[model samples]
Target: MSMDINEVPSVDPKEEPHAAPPRGNLRKYDPLDMESASFSTHHGQAAKATDWMTILQLAFQSIGVVYGDIGTSPLYVYSSTFTDGIKHKDDILGVLSLILYTITLLPLIKYVFIVLRANDNGDGGTFALYSLICRYAKVGMLPSQQAEDAEVSNYQLDLPNNRFRRASRVKSTLENSKFAKYLLLFITLLGTSMVIGDGVLTPCISVLSAVGGITQATSAMTEGRVVWVSVGILICLFVVQRFGTDKVGYSFAPIITIWFLFIGGIGIFNFVNYDPSVAKAFNPKYIIDYFRRNKKDAWISLGGIVLAITGTEAMFADLGHFNVRSIQISMCTVTFPSIILAYMGQASYLRTHMEDVGETFYKSIPGPLYWPMFVVAVMAAIIASQAMISGTFAIIQQSLSLGCFPLVKIVHTSPKHEGQVYIPEINYLLMLACVAVTVGFRTTQKIGNAYGIAVVFVMTLTSALLVLIMILIWKTHIALIIGYVIIFCSVELLYLSSVLYKFVDGGYLPLAFAAILMVVMYVWNYVYRKKYTYELDNKVSPHKLKEIADNLNFHRIPGIALFYSELVQGIPPIFKHYVANVPSLHSVLVFVSIKSLPISKVPQDERFLFCRVEPRELAVFRCVVRYGYKDFHERDSFQEILVDRLKEFIREEQWISPPTISSNGDVNGNAMDNGEVTNEEEEIRRKEIVGREIELVETEYNAGVVHLLGENEVVASQGSNIGKRILIDYAFNFLRRNLRQRDEVFDIPHKRLLKVGMTYEL
Candidate 1:
């Protein structure tokens, strides 16, 4: 059996490797050993865990929805290079070759090859990177997230005390934690915020870009109502999102596959038409010629080239949700080749009609095929926008989880599917923001004018942090730093520079927004850290500790006392007071606190806390709570655990504290919400957040800390209303514990679940 009462084994969804301790070393706590160091400095353990599918699914979904923009740029690349407006000397083959390189190197090589590989505990994006650094990186001066589980303790929650009934309910509550829900909500909100910008821009730009694309296919319909058609299609696209992605999503992968084939086919047809020279683009001579021969027009060419690489940042940020390997597979297999071919095809068509400035390009694909292609283009564009939208949610959760932001409400959207999550307040606000962005931008050209920079800035931030992770945390030699820094920073900088070139052309807007977001998140997180880290109790009193040891049953197991402490040197404030009252302390006591890590992997030397602070029988047992960044926290969990260890610690002189009564005059207990605490439950919530209530609070009147040590060995069933005090503690052998719980089992109601309408992958 698992050692901790709060430890729930993984289920089918347990397919994701949890951040729990290994079976052999799970630690349970005891409160009776006042001098026992249960939670202090101990970190000697080593184990590695992997779950590639969960990693990929999460990464893909996060960025696929919002980052799809960069993913589908292939739709335009093939044609853009061939169009007469580009003024390139390359034939179809040359254009095709160039397109191949662009797709391969920029998106695949720079991001997936390097950037995407750096994950913050399977969390991605710039902020996730920030959190990882703050927590574990030993970079000369960076602070870490060694703070308490403020979100849990900050909010006031009442735990019931019908003894057996309450313990049973609390066990169930602790087993199903709350981290996952909060994370989903936070990330979803952030993604939606970005999409509000994309929703408007994508409609105007993607459709218009495709319409402009038609002008590259052939020359028949360039003079007519392209604007009207584009606008009409965009309207329909926006309306469809309300229905959700489930039905549409079933066909998403296949449809995209077919679209890839269509893209390659068009490229091949154009290649055959002119048998274009592959060597032309490679010379660097043509690029020089274009600049020297037409210096005035080169800026526009640069702008167009820059557009080709705009979505790469989203590619990296979304990699965590889509696992690096799957992204590599998907891109190499379908997304990449098609993009290259499409670009080549567009280039080939442009070569055939050298005299035409975009006129012949549109006229080339002269049939009903344009409508289907148009729909595909719109669908792909929406997919791109959605990827970023979803990423926002993931980003927020990660940020909050790593202490970048305060707590917010998180709601799980899927029953069994861990990835299907939704946030209503976040959703409605995102919709409003997305619609506003779509209407505000009004054109892809305009949106494009401002896009690319926010992500690049994020990319820059990530690269800087990655350098810190690789060199400092990983402890690589200086020899590797040059090559790593040179290659990573160079590519990121080149793209960022391109984005910078467009700053005046409207790029500053995104950078400005990114800055604002960073500030707000940083401030909230900082405030919460300080508040939660403050003295948990202003003072620990001897009187309270005295009454606690006097009031309960002692177990036969090895007696242990576990208390958390701030500094390793001094005794815990509570313990100082605890020993004064109990007089007789346990044989061994423990002090504990989490030794957080960026990777969260336990090292070989830091697992168990065994130190002789005093002597053989009297020692301080300490432990450092080491777990994954994605795990959640629970309350009263450790206390119930001592109940079992009481059975194990048969020789120690550990005494128990009586369960305290609430100020409301009732024995209160219970979890405020449902479900296990995944990142979904442990939203990167801030401590200073108002409104939400803490689970437990110590007021002036109810000034005692209650500790329960298992099935009641003694009976002090009721308090006679006044000044009389009883001195006898009886073992309640007649009080049937199992019978009371069995009767209450059917009394609890199941949680009701409602869907937020999220399945539109179609």
Candidate 2:
């Protein structure tokens, strides 16, 4: 008889169903069931503030974490821009106008309003953008995607009838063309690499500029002493990163808030007293006139002017820490105004004291408040560094989940905050890079060149990705998309060209860093995909499994064995290899495949999906444990959860197929054919069976639960080309030997673990 897919079988004895049924069993479980399962238990979007108080509180907190980097830009924007010194008073107005409009257009208009809306379930950064697009299109590099992944709550986007055709066309093109997919991947990796580079340069430049104020305060402090002080501060900043953003953000928020207020107040003082005429910079005509007058000089100065929006990407990158509303509220209400006034005030001060353009921010400060503001400046700089450092950790975590980067230890610093993570290896590397850059560059000018290259390149890549997001995901109008591309890309390209001019003069640092990082990310991803493909292609069949089980010499041990595999369907080849060599199996066998989805978090109830593999009495089951990019699974708790779920599945099977008596007085695994048993009798019998099953499962689990992990070595086949050989044999092997192993990542105890050795010739 035909049965509804969602309806659990009433008396099926040989099979057990699950939300995400294994491949080749689609007929048994409706595709729609999988879709419903994915969305029913999880939130559709990232948690958002529902009240004004929460929004305000988060906005205040964001001021410390998100706005620090951008807020501190005023400290060096003037000095960095007019490296050859300001020629005329109009130069001040021109640069200030550029700064005002750049911040307004890029950070405020483009990012806050537009790109912020493109976050992947409230998580931002280049990888988040890539994840969003991957969900909408079948362009992800991994071949392991299941239908449930597409049906994830936030993965499905609704489109208007008019836009649906266009969106579908875009998706179709991306799926059909391999080049488009690789191009998208390249753009994402490039942007991520640049952000990491910026993470290093930010601490160096921000701290150096802030501490350089010591020279202005007193000549007794040499430039060398200032550099060392900056280095010390940077070291301290990186050391505290292990504390995570929740703690660091709270401490940093007040310092950034006061820094903004101080700069705004001082700006008003300078604007009114020094040159009220500098207010004319609010007009775009000064930008045009100054550019026309200075020509190539003004064009080249964009490399420095771009630094005004240095931390703009941080606002989006750190979105996982705060909601979009909080970011918008904080930026528009607090950050934007304070920064504008700070620039106007600096320009106003420069209008009169053109000779002090090199030291405009400190020179503009009132003599009495110099030291106090200097201290605040240094503190704010460190906080700015905190924003980039935190963002770097976040991006790396996302990369790790997506299989683009090698495994690293990720510590979730706050129990209350899911997104606040600390990577010990990344933190120390950034600290060293920051120290080296600070000591190597010695001045903000050289570091600023490298900093500008990384910043504008990331922004430009964001714009490119956003264009696709607009078309395929947002289903935005073509006209609007074109306008966005023209406006944002044009300005970003101008800044990019200006920065490229300084490639020999420290601009190469970020590029060099990005190149190295890109190679590592690309090589790791290449080998990762190759390895997954090998496992998938060589998976053992059910026929082979039955043969292994039917062998007379094979014995079932009195314990549970969980064989970990990357493949979610058939048994991994390593299992076959293990059984062929060992000649033994556990009483209960579970093939566990841990899959990482593109979203932020998977619901606990929906995390484990159980399916019974054929050969009924063998006690073999498959469990797929799915995790999102931001989700964490503790070692002991995970095992407990898995065991409980297994027992629960056993009880469910017993309830569906209780023992019954046939007309011939024979006990069968179905309800009584003669109606000899009452409903209450059947209920009692089912409960007893469930109790027995649960007890048996508990006993086996208690005896010992062992984790069977594959210790596979990947190598190039003899017939493969030299390039493949080098990549697979040497590069991939080196990374594998150095990085964390699968068992270590899962924190499986050595006593409870068994490694099956094999070789994959790719």
Give Cα-based local distance difference scores for all models.
0.43, 0.82
Estimate the TM-score for candidate 2.
0.91
Report the error of model 2 at residue 201, Å.
0.4
Please report how far candidate 1 places residue 658 from its true position, in Å. Answer: 18
Estimate, for each residue in 1-762, the C-alpha lDDT of model 2 and write its tens digit: 111211232323343442343222222232111211121244454555458886787788899988888999998988889999988878888898899899999999999999999888779999999988877677888766665555455556554356378888787788789999899999999999999998999989889889998888689999999999999888888888888888888899998999999999999999899899988888999999998999999999999899999988998898887779999999998899999999999888888889998888899999999999999999999999877888898899889877899888888887866888898989998999889888888999999999999999999999999998888877778899889878889999999999999999999999999998998899999988888878777887778877976889989899899989877655678888898899988888888888887777776756776666655556787777888878887677777788898776655444233345454544454545556766666566656656765787788898889999988898898799999999889987888888788887788889989888999899
Cα error, residue 127 of model 2, in Å, equals 0.9
Q: Please give the TM-score that candidate 1 achieves against the real structure.
A: 0.58
What clash count does candidate 1 reach? 128
* Per-residue lDDT of candidate 1, residues 108-185 (tens digit): 776777666666544566655544433332121112222221111111112333533533343344234444323332
* TM-score for each of the candidates: 0.58, 0.91
Give the residue spans of candidate 2 off by over 4 A: 1-51, 159-163, 651-692
